[model samples]
Target: MEQKLLNSPQSEVNVIDSLFAEMVLDKALLDFRKKKIQQKIDQSLQDRNKREFLRLSEKLKDLS
Candidate 1:
């Protein structure tokens, strides 16, 4: 029982570390996607494409 108690913290730490890694990955992916969408939105403006602009705007809004 003493050994089990000592080993339990390691398991808890592993779970916490795994969750942190996942959160970092998710944030990075989200930042990448938002950057890409903004680029498209800018291009849409430069090209004077109203339809594309509105569509990309909604996509960017949905991310937030």
Candidate 2:
């Protein structure tokens, strides 16, 4: 009976289906983490830009 099940086409299909599902989940999780890290980096850059702009504006005011 075990040999017969192994030879069956359905068993092969089920194995392939499970493997594809696992690959998809792994890719999705990786993408989510990548996006989250990018957002944090962008926020840091924005903050730095704002601080530099303010500093420059203060210098211009002092010169005037």
Candidate 3:
């Protein structure tokens, strides 16, 4: 039975083949968007850190 099924050409045209390509494309787009958002968040955090550091440094200088 398995040999007979494998011998059929129509079996190759399954649901997986029809949807796999589209799914891969969608995944790539989603990954790109996620990376872009992550980069923006990282930049914002770095900016915040620099501002805090400078503020602290100024306060220390005033104390002296």
Candidate 2 lDDT, tens digit per residue, 8-28?
899899999999999999989
Candidate 3 matches the true fold with a TM-score of 0.50
The CA lDDT at 29 in model 3 is 81
Better of 1 and 2 by TM-score: 1
lDDT per model vs. reference: 0.95, 0.69, 0.64
State residue 41's C-alpha deviation in candidate 1, in Å. 0.3
**Model 1 lDDT tens row, 1-64:** 4454546988889889999999999999999999999999999999999999999999999998
Q: lDDT (0-100) at residue 24 of candidate 1?
A: 100
Where does candidate 2 clash, by residue pair? none
Model 1 scores what on Cα lDDT?
A: 0.95
lDDT of 3 by residue, 1-64 (tens): 4454754666666656768888999889877766665565566567887665555555545534
Task: Give the candidate order by descending TM-score.
Answer: 1, 2, 3
Model 3, residue 18: what's the lDDT?
Answer: 67
Which model, 1 or 2, shows the larger lDDT? 1
TM-score of 2: 0.63
Instruction: For each candidate, give its TM-score against the true structure.
Output: 0.89, 0.63, 0.50
